[model samples]
Target: MFSNPFTPIFGGKPDVFFGRDKILELFELAMFERGSDERLMFITGTRGFGKTALLEQMSIRAMKKRKVIDLGPDDTVEQFITELCGYDEVVKTVSPQANLNILGVGGGVSGGSISKAKHIGREKLQPLLLDFCSKNKQGLLVTIDEIQKVSLEDVSSICNAFQMASRKGYDIMFAAAGLPYSYDKIVQHTGCSYLRRSVHEEIGLFTWDEASDALNEMFSGIKGLQIDQSYLDEINKFSYGHPYIMQLLGYHLILCINENKPKARHTVSEVELKKAEQNTLLAYQHRALKPLLDEFSGQERKYLMKMSECLDSNRLTATSDIAKALGTTQNKLSKVRETLIAHGIIAAPERGKVMFCVPYLADYVKQEAVNSSVISVARQRGV
Candidate 1:
């Protein structure tokens, strides 16, 4: 029996990663061309849109020609310098004692011995970074994932430093991934003004062709498992090319096909496919959609609930209907629409229309709405 080929873990680098060849090509070109405008790339998207996975992929390629350092989402500007302290080039400029302390300092401390040794403020992050970059002839690639989770102030402090470093034309590159909302907020900040010019890559839904090719390649190696166009069509339709859903459906479908049988026909059955679909939807509701709902504001939630009411068979909703239901003008809802679009929750397919970008969002909204009504009625009845 073949081990499950689908990688469902968030940010887990899949063995058969696909649909990002164009992006990888662009990044490689940026690396090869000195002072290329595209060196600083920011990938943004909703949860599980493959931002973190893409960052990991870039780090793998960047390591071959440069010093690559990956900073976790919570790591602030201070941590960036502390990471620099571990390097020989930067250590030469600082006291030897600081080098020993850098590794041992905990979260309570800010900057540790490196901060005391250099007396450098967090805003001056570029100087040490530049020094390190100057020494590295092959250049340095700094990749950070989920940057939107950090405070904008912390983000800007580092952005200002990076902007200065980039202006100086040092051998340095910064690639970051985060929710799309932060891109506008960060760029508008005075401290991160320079980031307005940086590259923005949205790791979004895959095309049908991209999704089909990926699924075909993923299952092709399994001798005991067999799939054809019909299975592929069902999986693609249900997943809608969302990377996370694609993985989830593919994983569950494989399990359903086998059904713990000692031996069975490799071909997929309708019963198995239906079971997989049910499992995928349940998993999506809890694992994927719940966190997103938590992030929604009251108004945003209301907007979505209202939109869900107006959903057509095609999954599209009219902006006019939403505005009318909300007792607001379309102009008033424009900002909400823009926010939803940025969040990857909805798309405006054409003039005066918006569509839920994720599969089953409409059904989820309806269920939540019904539950809310039940709670409201119980409260009134004092049951």
Candidate 2:
């Protein structure tokens, strides 16, 4: 049996881990080539492909050699700027009373004046980043996850700061992680030169070999808890090698197998495994999916109901096919797809093909849409 070494947010190494062989290699390359102009790296994946785990590893590395300014989405531009200044004197010198009108710290503003001032604060912080990195030998690693949440206009300033830091021989590296589409969106929103400064890495599901190796290592120390090859393959098939789900399922299995109950055994059958998977997946849907489903409009709900069926069958429907499925034209489907992608419901990999971002949603949609009982329940409640 394997145990979870992951935090709730999927940070840190799990008790068992696998895959990311090439990613660790890239980190070595980045470390070896530090202080170069090409310091920024964009790591992208869907919501649960272990982006946070990779970031946590990098965070440890950054702490060893430099200072890491970790910024979450809620950090204000003023707060961001204040931290980047590095000098307590500089922050103290900015007279708190001098900018009281523009500063909505205490909150009393409906005008664009305060909003524009906030943008300026973020934009002007670029030079400060360069100065701080130049003055300090510890260097700076700024990692902002879920960067798609930030406005495009604001991303431009952040990118400029990273570029400036790189040019000035400041080992200021910017590593951002977000959904798959964020790379193109960022490039389109920023200029060409700015785009040229960073490298991009796409995180995907783990391979069979990687999953096998991870399971082997995790259970190696435990007696009578070895995994069969067939069972391992089934786990991979069900998880699709998605790291978060892989670890999660592994965690529950270990817990169940280790229990002192009369039925306790180190082995879980295929039937039991499926039950575990379904229960875990449905729990996630109940917690995270219900709220988002409630927010959908009638048209969005109908389109998604159809889309869910397609994804459940592992079918990637093109724009035209999806339109036909929804009884709408390609242009209309395109608009709905964009909205779904933005809301993190459905995903469009390249152009036309679409699938659910969440596997459970795909299954739930199919079940709910096609089942007469579910439809009767929906009608009873007027959903």
Candidate 3:
């Protein structure tokens, strides 16, 4: 039996990832080009848009010529420096003659304590990285994922370190991925204001061609299973160019076929495709939409529900109509409107119209609202 190649997991890079050629090109330029301002990059997008995957891929490329440091939301700048200095590979690259432990600590190098290094501020860390780059003749790559969860103070500190290192002509590169709100916050910080000059990339849905090509490639070479062009088109339309949903649809479609006969050659039928589509929607609702909706505040959810109520046949709801439905003026809805737009949950298509950024999201919101109301009624009636 052939394994399913589609992966719906967030940040999970499939065996054959596609549709990011331009971004990867930019990343390569950043990694190799000296004095390139693109060395600092900020990637922002909605959930499941492959921001983390992109970062991971860039890190893989960077590792060929640089010491890559991975940071998380809870990591402070001091911790980052400590980890970098303590990394065995970094230490070996910098000082090849030094005999160090696995962590590059506790050897013949000034007591070799990571705890001692942790207390060093940017003033000390910058020189260390500069020295390493000077010796290894390579740069440093620091990748931070989920930037929105990081604190402004920590962001300031990290950016300061990079800025100081870059000022000394050290080949230091920084890449961060986060939601729009987090990106906005970083841009607004005075200490890291230099990021405003860095390359800002907004990740969006895959193009129709990109999505179709991905599906075709994933379905190719599977034993005894052939998907017709019409079925492929249907899957693409149902995915609506959303990368994660496309993966889900492909995954479920394969499962739908294999459930009947795991090891047999079979032509996929329209009926099987339809069932796969249904299962994909259900999986998306639970795995993606529900959690995304749960992150909204009461007021944000209210705005979404009202917009869902006003959705037209084209799936676009006028901002004024949403305000009217909420019994508020458009001015009063500005905050929620901007918030949703920043979160990539909705887009202002025109001067007066807004739409769910994800296809079928409006329908999901409506269904969720109905389910909530039903549960409320049940609880009130003690059912």
Candidate 4:
């Protein structure tokens, strides 16, 4: 019923961005400071952890000092060169030599256009990238989101280009972001060794104070929008500092509040909040939790299920207890525990204990198991 300021969709820039000042400070210093190793950084986090949103923020800052090109899964360096060649900054310098101008005039582009980008480390991309860095006073910044989904073909070319640029001291910088395991997977490929040595920062959950400030500032900024401090605390508990979940919860809460009070002029009611919580959980389960669960191995998932079963009131579960529930020894579950921790799915916050980093994961896993059991029983009875 209200125009929601929160962006619940993945990779969207919310109206009021939450805290990432620490990371942004480093990014700014790297952007402006020469010989700073943080220039090429990688942000790693699980799904819905706001890797893409952070990249968006970096690009905003990057544009002031560098030419920013943000790429998604479908984008390629060939398309990049084609576009970059015609851009005002580059066209003035390289337009005559670039094939982009030739294609539109009397002559169409030759097969070399495709062939050039396909095979790099030769003379295709590296040359143009070097040229751009040379001609433009402000360097070029390339940010790739969902790096895991980016093709090896494209990744190699970009890596080779930037590697050359970095060695030559040309003003060039690149940043990538993806799932927690994405770095491990990509670096194994040939010519990606630089990523292994580059700055890698793991994006984690929002701290309580950060979430609190974001909630208060976001709500107070909206005209005639008021949520009681108690409900805000409830929201903090529900969201548990996960970025995307917070956005979804805020959006649905605002919606329910608007529906309950016409003109959005009153403090929200308990009934409205109850409905909003339900909507938030359902949306989080489908949009975030499901995809995350789908990525894990069977043993890892079983570990999570058993761990959820043994979770204490504080949401902390003992590894030994989970191992017992799984009919395995504590030693055998160590690998599974570490795997989840490495993926940012779980954390061993205390000695011999683990907790779900994402909120409602325990409940979602239990509910998913119940749904699967219901389907299995229905199939057996042919109902």
Q: Pick the candidate with the highest TM-score.
A: 3
Give the residue spans of candidate 2 off by over 4 A: 1-17, 35-38, 91-120, 190-193, 221-224, 261-275, 287-298, 308-314, 318-321, 338-360, 370-383
User: What is the per-residue lDDT of model 4 for residues 1-383, given as tens digits with 9 covering 90 to 100?
Assistant: 45678878786776667777788898899887887777889899987878888899999988877789888877576556654554344424433335543323433344333333322222467888777778887788888888888888778778888888889887777889988878888888897877776788898888888888888877787787677899888888788888898899889988887765567477678898889989998888888889989988889988988889899999899998998898989999888888898788898889999999877888888888888899999999999
* Residue pairs with backbone overlap in model 3: 224-265
Instruction: Indicate whether candidate 1 or candidate 3 has the larger TM-score.
Output: 3
Per-candidate Cα RMSD to the true structure, in Å, reads: 4.3, 5.7, 5.0, 4.9
Q: Please, what is the TM-score per model? A: 0.86, 0.77, 0.88, 0.84
Return the lDDT, model 4, position 296: 88
Indicate the worst ten consecutive residues by lDDT in candidate 4: 113-122
State candidate 1's TM-score.
0.86
- Which residue pairs show backbone clashes in model 2? 5-14, 5-15
Error of 1 at 204 (Å): 1.6
lDDT tens readout by residue for model 1, 1-383: 34677877776686556677788898999898976766888889878888888888899999998888888766566567767765443435555444333334432332333434422446457677777777778888888777877777777777777777778877778888888787887778787776777788877889999998888888786777667788788898889889999888888887776565625447667877889999999998998887788788888988999999988887788999999999999999898889898888998898988988777787898888899999999999999
Q: Over the full model, what C-alpha lDDT does candidate 1 score relative to the true structure?
A: 0.79
lDDT (C-alpha) at residue 154 in model 3? 77
- CA displacement after TM-score superposition, residue 52 of candidate 1 (Å): 0.8
- TM-score attained by model 2: 0.77
For residues 1-383, could you state the per-residue lDDT of candidate 3 as single tens digits? 55678777876665556677888897898777886767889999998888888888888899988888888877556568666566544433434345445333454443233323234344456666666667766678888998888888778877776777778788788899998777877888898786887888898888888888877877885666787988888888888888888888888887887788755767888887899889988988998898998998998998998899988999789999988888889999899999999999999988989999866778888898889999999999999
Superior candidate under TM-score, 1 versus 2: 1
140 in model 3: Cα distance from truth in Å? 1.9
Query: After aligning candidate 2 to the native by TM-score, how far in Å is the CA of 162 from where it should be?
Result: 2.4
